[model samples]
Target: MIESDIKRYELLLDLLQKSKKEQDEQNNTLDQKCSSMINILILIITIQCGIYANVALLNEIASSEIAIIIKVLLIITLIGNFIALYFFIAAYYLKDFEGMTNEEDIIKYGENNTNLETIYKEISVDYKRTIEENKIELSKIDKIKLGFKIVTLTTGIFVLTIIICLEILI
Candidate 1:
């Protein structure tokens, strides 16, 4: 019975470790995406704002035909970009995820000459806790990423519209 329990824990530990590895990989992927998207958003916003400012200055006359349209488009674009940026920033800045058993725990286990079964049980329990915590965090990030994606799509459309407006109407 003892050997069987130990074998079970060994299997459990292996599975939990695999799950943790997958989650870590997922977290890294999302982090990279968020970082890249933020940089691109910043660049696009900067360029768009610069264009809008220059155009507004040149078309300062109150009677100018395209001034009002340009102002409206710029306002919508800014709002969309702002919302998308919020999602990205929130996801990117989320709390750090819990990881597997730390080095100190390993050292303590070694020094205490912990039984194999005890070690497996302790490590597995720790892995389970970390996995649960990571799951919650990942779920939150997934929701935020969805929001970012939708807003980014809408914002991209608005930006393209603004470009078209600037090109043909300016």
Candidate 2:
């Protein structure tokens, strides 16, 4: 009965992983399309402002140079968003392809790979066999989560810096 329960639990976890993977894929695709559309729209707006609207704005303003500069800044803002999006999408995809991401898909697709399972089984056994095992209050699960958090946080911060620079330029 216990074995059956374990098997059932494993199946549930596998389903969860697959669901998570699908969610991640959908989110990623949405992000890419959304970002591209936003960038293109922003570019169009900047062009309009520079070629047509800015003439009227400059008429009301004291300096044409400042109007042109403002348009340039708007374009720069779009570029900044592109950079940040590129960074985020690249990281997500690379992690996904490697099956190293903390995504639920990782759990679903991970253990099914026969070779990887064998390697991980050895690693898990060795780690447990070591006297230092279980020294941390947190479970192995927590450690994996923490590692992913660290990576995500680091990349997010750098992306934020680019955003900040865009703001400052604006």
lDDT, candidate 2, 46-156, per-residue tens:
553454443344435435665555555545544544454444344333322222234554465556664544434443444333313212223322433443444345345
- Please estimate how well model 2 matches the true structure, expressed as its whole-model Cα lDDT: 0.45
lDDT of 1 by residue, 50-128 (tens): 8767666536543466667767766677777777777787887785777678899999999998899889989999999
**All candidates' lDDT scores?**
0.76, 0.45
Highest TM-score: give the candidate number.
1
Error of 2 at 68 (Å): 22
Candidate 2 least-lDDT 10 residues: 131-140
In model 1, what lDDT does residue 61 have?
46
Q: What local lDDT does model 2 show for residue 35? A: 50
Q: How close is each model in CA RMSD to the real structure? A: 3.1, 13.0
Question: How does residue 132 of candidate 1 score in lDDT?
Answer: 89
For candidate 2, what is the TM-score?
Answer: 0.32
